[model samples]
Target: MPLPHLLRRRAPRSGARRTARRLAVTVPLVSLAGVLALTGCANRERDAAPGAGTSTTASSAAQTAAFPVQVTVPGTDHAVTVERRPERIVSLAPSSTESLFAIGAGEQVVAVDNQSNYPEQAPRTDLSGYTPNIEAITGYNPDLVIASNDTEQLVASLEKVKVPVLLLPSPHNLDELYAEVTALGKATGHLTEAEDLVRTMRSDIDKIVKDTPKPAKQLTYYHELDPQLYSATSRTFIGQIYGLFGLVNVADAAGGTGDYPQLSPEHVINANPDLVFLADTKCCGQDAAAVAARPGWQSVTAVRDNGVVALNDDIASRWGPRVVDLVRTVSDAVTRTAQQG
Candidate 1:
C-alpha cells in the first residue's frame, strides 16, 4: 500500500526547531511527516455566501492594499514579501491548493501539483511536490508559488528563477492554522474572503465543541494512522483534535519517540480503548470489520461494541477547512458512544 504522505518521515530542518517554543503545548517536536500530514488536502468546497461574486472588485482592492506586505511564514525564519497581489499562482501542496480555492483565489491558480485532486476543478499538473522540478514549475510562469515543506533546494531553485515561494508548513495548533489562511488570503488578494472563511470555521468548530457534551467519564480512543498500529499522540495536531472531546489517547503511554509512533498490536490489545478511529479507510481499506478480524483485536472494547469510526483519509489527514467536517464526525461518534453507555 502506498504510504500516505502524512505518515512518511522527512528530514529534520531548522524550521522545526524554530517553532518548538511556540508549540510547547504539543508533545514531541513536529516532524516533517507530522507537518506533511497537517498540510495535505482533498475535495469538497465549503458553501459560498450568496452574492459572493458581487464583491470581487472591492475584495480585490482590499487585497491590493494589503499587498507589498511582508508576512513571516510559520515554522520558518524566512519572511516572504509579496510585492503585489499575485495574479498567477502555483500550488505545490494539496492543502495550499485547497486554501487558495476556499479563499476565492482559485481563479488565480495557474496549476496545482499532481496530488491536488480536490474541488475537482484545480488545474492539475504532473508537477511533483516531493521532487520539485524547477523547470516544469517555472514553465507556468507563476508569479507566486505556495508550498508546505521548504526544502532548501526547492526554495533556492525557485528563488533563482525569480519566482517568490511561500512556505506554509503544517500548523501546530488552530491559531497557526488561522494565521496560515490569513497569509494565503493576503498573498492572493483574497483577504476579505479568507477572513470570512476563518471566522466561519472558528465559529463552526467552537459550536461543535460547545454542543457536544463530554462523556460522563473520560473515553479512551485509539487513532489508527495505518493498519500496522502507527498512531498519533495527543501532542500531534490530529491528537489535539481528539483532545477537544476530552478523549484520552491510548498511544500517549506507548513510549513512542516521535509524533507519529508505531504501536504494537499487543500493546493496543492490552489497552483495549473504548473507541477506534481509522484514518486509513481509503488508503489501506481498513474498516471496523477488518479491524475486528485482526487476531486478539476482536476482544477490544471498541471493536466488540461497534465503536469503530471509519473516516475519510483526506479529511482526517488534512488541516484545511474540511477540519470542521472531521471534528463534527468525531463529535457525533462521541455523542453516540456517550449515550450508549
Candidate 2:
C-alpha cells in the first residue's frame, strides 16, 4: 500500500522502459494484486571466497590504493572499468547504498536515491530508482552510478555521457548477496573491506542458524509481503532464510510457480501455519493483533499460540549487510515458538 512497495513491483519489461510501463499504469499498484507474479531478477558475481563461516580482517588504506578496477556486471558479461577510486559516487539502489556504506565506501558516495533510508548519514536525494531522471541524476556530477536495474536505459544513457555505471540486481540468495557486496568493493576500490564484511556476514548467519533450536515438529510459516495476503514461497530469498531454520513455507503448498503469490484469505486460514511473519508492519500497519483480528484467523495456530512475528519491512526486503539482522529476527521467532511448543 506504500509508495515504496509500488516502486518495488516494477511492471514487466526490459531496461529503463520497465519504469515507463510502471508509470503508465493508471491505477495504483496495491498489495501486488494487479501486478504479475515477479521474482527478483538481479544477479551477482561469484563469491570472493569459498568458506561460509570464516572471518577476515582487512586494511582499508591498502585496499583503496588498488585502482583502475574492472568488475563484470552480474547476470551480464558487460565489464565496467573504474579508472580511479571514485570520489563522487551516486547510488540508486537501496541495497547497494547499504552495501557501499558497510564496505567503508561511505565517504565516496556523493548522493543516493530517496529510498536508501538506512545508515542515517546517507546523502539522500530525490533521484528516483523507479522512474529515474538522467538530468537530475547527472546534476550530482557523479563519477560512478550504482543501480539495481537498468531502468529507463540508465546504463546506455550514462555511457553516452561517459559516466561509469554499476548495475547490481537484487540477489536471490546469500551467495549472490555476497557476490554483490564483493563486486561493490572492487568497483569502489574497497575489495578487502567488502570481502571482510562478507566473511563476517557469513559467519554471523551460520552462527544464527546453528544457534536456533530445532522444534519438536517442523514449523510451517507464512511470510506476509503485504496486508493483501501476498506471500513468499520457499523459493524466494526471504523464504530461503526461513528454510535455514528448518521452517516450511505454507505458500509453497498453494501450488504457484512464482516466488511471490497473492493468496486468498481462506487459503491462509486453511493452511493454518504455525508461524506468521508480517513484513507489512510499516507498509500496511499489520502486526500480531492485526492478523489475529482477521475474520476466522482466530482459528489459526499462529494466532492462538502467539507465534506471530513482526518484522521491519525494509530489512526484510533488502539483502544487504543488515540481512544478518533479518536472520537473527527469524532465529528469535523460531526459538520462541520452539520453546512454546
lDDT of 1 by residue, 128-233 (tens): 7766888899999999998876654888888887888988777766777788888888777777777877887788879988999778889999987666677778
Task: Report the lDDT tens digits of candidate 2 across residue range 13-127.
Answer: 3332332222121101111100000111011121235342132223445555677788985655667888888999999877778778877688789998877776678899889
> Candidate 1 regions off by >4 Å?
1-52
lDDT of each: 0.71, 0.71
RMSD, every candidate, angstroms: 6.8, 8.9
lDDT of the structure predicted as candidate 1: 0.71
Q: Which portions of model 2 miss their true places by more than 4 Å?
A: 1-61, 73-75
Model 2: per-residue Cα lDDT at residue 136: 95
Clashing residue pairs for model 2: 16-151, 16-152, 16-153
- Counting clashing residue pairs in each candidate, in order, gives 0, 3
* TM-score on alpha carbons, each prediction: 0.85, 0.83
